[model samples]
Target: MEEERLVTQVTPKSEDFSRWYLDLIRRTELADYAPMKGMMVIRPYGYAIWENIQRLLDERIKASGHVNAYFPLFIPEGFLRKEMEHLQGFAPEVAWVTQGGADELEERLAVRPTSEAIIGFMYSKWVKSWRDLPVLINQWANVVRWEKVTRPFLRTTEFLWQEGHTVHETYDEAQAETLRILDMYRQFVETELAIPVLYGRKTEQEKFAGALATYAIEALMSDGKALQMGTSHNLGQHFARVFNIRFEDHNQSLQYAWQTSWGVSTRLIGALVMAHGDDSGLVFPPAVAPFQVVIIPISIGNWKENTLPRAVELRSRLERVGIRVFLDDRSEYTPGWKFSEWEMRGVPLRLEIGPRDVKNNQAVAVRRDNKEKLIVSLDGVEAKIKGILDGIQASLFDKALAFQKENTCQVSSYQEFKSVIENKRGFVQAFWCGSEECEARIKEETMATIRVIPLEEEKNQKGKCIFCQKEAGTLAVFARSY
Candidate 1:
């Protein structure tokens, strides 16, 4: 018991957060450094969490009329070059495939940093009329980009994600589709992942290459930094014109189609860890937790013989109610050891069934988020666990929303903006002049960029740029991002 207790006290919150994150990931067997620099291996435990995310998001995408499809992992050099802006945007990080077996390939193939060009080329070939409009397709794949620095699930040389590509006949249709997907992503992150987000449009300078407009969902992390949780782009006619994707109109004239693309990567998992995890380790929301409950049977001396049956029965009962439950029946580890282990893994709820509690017809239920425990009667343990899971999910979202509100600040002067960014470290809501020069100057001085310009314009109060003091155009949220 003494040795087991020491393991739980290995690291505390007052220490460095980065070190705490590294220790949590390692100790919980979530991930490991790969042989290559700036790359990581997601262990089974971590992958299980990712699997849950994938399952939930995929269902939502499918329900929204998007069909799953696949495209080539490697794109020809000329294909990427077709869209000059996109080539320039992604050129810095692209990983080229030059050799095949022992022979050097004639034209270097670029492992897709994104599938826009490849998918656009296919759309050009497949769609010849308005009937082929709105080719809604999604693909789940891995992409590679060489990076100077990387964190486990945050930034990596290679990462897994789902990308959605859709084509529409009219500009209005395409623009509406772009916003719709952005809202979908926002809903998924907020409802399913239990993280609150700020949704708005990206400035022209920060918009995706080959896109006329870009929309994003940004979430504030516990470290006072921002993470671009997801993005949806309106490609306009750029790709359609480049790929010669034109359709004959009802009036018998040919016109270019409008396109849109969007994606959310595994970086979201990283956001979850940074936003909600603590020194005690991860605290997952019930919606995404792989195992909603873990049952640990506590025994000392002869209590083991009597406690085992009750724990087994409880596990069976929970499973019957369609709850994901794991029974830790390992005799080698103490009940206290199991508690810390599951807590590190971020199991939503934990049930401890000891000899004393079994006799009392109750089990102690603990929540991972608050570490609060309550005695729940075994008579309706299934329903009780379900209610606790729902409560944890709501509580996690409420806590994140509160943090966002606390960190967010409104500044009217340049000095105030700098102070808020440096000290508070979150979204600085202020008026912008809508000039690229002012945006560039702010970035140069503060290393903070305009994160989003809200769709709903503020009336009457706008006067001047917070930095340049020129006539202001709209309210923008600026932040230093991950």
Candidate 2:
């Protein structure tokens, strides 16, 4: 355990966000840069967080009637060319394999930048009748894109993610499935990750390539930058026409099937870091934290015999009730040092048990979010800890939601939009003429693009286009994003 070492200090989040993020990632042992450029290694602690995210989100995905499957990593170059739009969208980032052993391959194979082309090809073979209309399948896998700019989890050469590919008999069914997943993502991110997000459709220029329409959930990080948390694309029949995914209807008419694709990646871990972390260190929501409760036994004279046993027993009690607990009973680290270390790791609750606490049949519980301490009787410690954890999760969410609201502003003119983008740097709501020209100019001049367009009836409301001052009805959110 000496290898655990004393936790190192991180750069302040306010002083420098980029340095603070990289510093915290290393100091907290979440991830590290790999020997290869633009790649990262997910350490055990970080992987545990991802595992918890997978377990919880997988349940929701299965409940919605999607099944898991595996897909090939390499796509034949011709396969990518089947859908020119999707291929061109990923062309700049695609990695290729040109040789096998000592021999040059007859044709280059693409390390999948995305699975649309291959999955669409498979769907063509798998669907022959309307009964197989909705082929709902998902795959958890790693993907490669030769990224020029990379960050640990946010953007990398290779990363882990789950991509869901589905087929539908009708356009309405595919659109319904896409929105359903978008709302599901909203719930999962807001509830489990405790990060508030704005869910809506994207502009034409921002929608996924080959998609009729794309919807996403955008989250405002602590730094006032918007992060696209997840995306669901209504691919329509474009891929079906390209791959020949034809099915015979009950009426005996052949038709191309509509399709959809949606996914969220390990960049979510990066979201968790930015959305809720503070200058002290990481501040994790209880639902996804690796350890919800970390019990540290306070050291005193002959304390091992007196307090160590009780701390171990308390850990057993919590474990019995299915609470993730870590008992730091190491002799090498003092209680104070252990507290700082676990706090830096973002353990939600810390219970300190010393000889006095053992005698009093109580322990001191400290919260990582607010650093508030409370004395608890050991009688119903398990139930009490559960209540406190639920409160912490809710508290973190409320605090983040407040921050999002405080930073989000509604602006009527392009001047105000540019001012808000440069000064406050959060989500700015403004009307757009729904033209790529205006969207492109806004991004070029202000470095802020439309983050989302209202999904509900409000999208139909009329207003002046912030840039062109033309008759525009659609309101859009603009932000400089990661």
Candidate 3:
């Protein structure tokens, strides 16, 4: 906590985009690199945002019939090999433990890169018949994926997430469940985190390993690169068959259960930052902001007896109304420094009550999103603050939506696609022939991949493929992504 201020006046988000992000994270104390390579220590402020994210999403998941559960952090190696595709996909990144408590174990245990294999084993034991169908369970935990390269929340080796795994009696039920969770993810991220996302089916090249079909929500960051926000996959009895999760049907025939897996990780915190943060600092949506409002009392002589009490009162009122408010009455820091500090921390709104404000029965409010200032009367200030929080939340989503729309470009050919991808780095809309080879070629040449194939409606237009000169098969959005 005791370090030189890293955020002085360097231009953020313009020329040196990566530096801007690192500076904001370091200066504002969101996170810092840990002792282990490719891992990070999420500071308290960053953890608070994650807590809010968990709260909002957990409520939605529970309401949708999913129950919270826990599974082991390690999986038997044989379980991973049961699904060859999943094993091959995660084999390179898996960490192994061969010794336990000063004894060398006979079989090496794999750190859980994902729980599909272990959950599949449990499902086999728990689900026996249609009466036990639709076992919807979610686990909030940290996973280890030994990544070669990592960024704070984006690709850390160890990060936090909630993974939902469900089993259904029929294929149709599982498919429906997959889509239900996809829409749930879209709504949660857009409304709670203030990040608007593009929803669609993922291309085979990008779909989850071992999944019959994968759906994802893609968000455009401020720097023109795409960030994957969440993903849902229809497992289609693959894990059920492999793990022997069989059940009796209504007609007395034995059948394997249909399965689905979906998750969103701490990577979402990175998306939120890129989607809304500015040069000054983060611009958190009120819904997920640790402190929606920060109260600073601007005082002069004997002000502790005056403005401090008023500031405390206002803080109490705001707190009673369910607003996360912080009163900064520390005499060591000046009023201006407190404002900058809170601004860097991305409090949605700031309330400044000074000697004049106390005498006049008013306070000054500043918005972190736009840096707009308002002189507000103290009377009914709680209601006014509520309105301001809602406004800030909506404003952030609108601004991100507008930015995404503005950066998207529709192209008809590979030439135009390459040109646009090189000149402008946002989403490029083009028709894809639904071929893995063509998708690979395009990525090899332009370094941009299909972010998503917009949910069925965008595929209606008939045209030529952007990469291969074939009849248009599906409309897909392409971009250089993180």
lDDT of 3 by residue, 1-482 (tens): 11123347534566578888877787778899999999999999999999999999999999999999999999999999999888998999999999999999899999999999999999999998999988999999999999999998889999999999999998999999999999999999999999899998998889898899999999999999999999999999899999999999899999999999999999988887889987777889999998999999996888999888999999998899999999998999998889888887889999999899999998999999988999999899989999999999999999999998999989887888998888888999988888899999999999999989988745467878887779876888999999
lDDT of 2 by residue, 1-482 (tens): 23224444787788899998999999999999999999999999999999999999999999999999999999999998878888888899999999999999998999988899999999999999999978999999899989999998999999999899999999999999999999999999999999999989998888898899999999999999999999999999999999999999989999999999999999999999999887778989999999999999988889888889999999999999999999998999898889888888899999999988998999999999998999999999999999999999999999999999999988998889999999999999988888899899999999999999869725557898999999888888899999
Model 3 alpha-carbon miss at residue 183, Å: 0.4
lDDT of 1 by residue, 1-482 (tens): 35334446336444666766777777777788999988889888788888988999999899999999999999999989999999999999999999999999999999999999999999999888998887999999999988888888889999999999999999999999999999999999999899999999999999998899999999998878889999999999999999999998788789999999999998988888888987677888988887899999886767668888898999999899888889998999988778888888889899998877978999999999998999999998888889999999999999999999998888999999998888878888989998999999998988889888877754555677998898897889999888
lDDT of every model, 2 decimals: 0.89, 0.92, 0.91
Give the range where candidate 3 is weakest over 10 consecutive residues by summed lDDT: 1-10
Clashing residue pairs found in predicted model 2? none
Q: Between candidates 1 and 3, which one is better according to lDDT? A: 3
- Ranking of all candidate structures by their lDDT, best first: 2, 3, 1
RMSD of candidate 2 to the truth, in angstroms, is: 2.7
Clashes of 3: 0
Scored by lDDT, model 3 comes in at 0.91
C-alpha lDDT of candidate 2 relative to the true structure: 0.92
Best-fitting candidate, measured by lDDT? 2
lDDT at residue 294 of model 2 (Cα atoms): 97
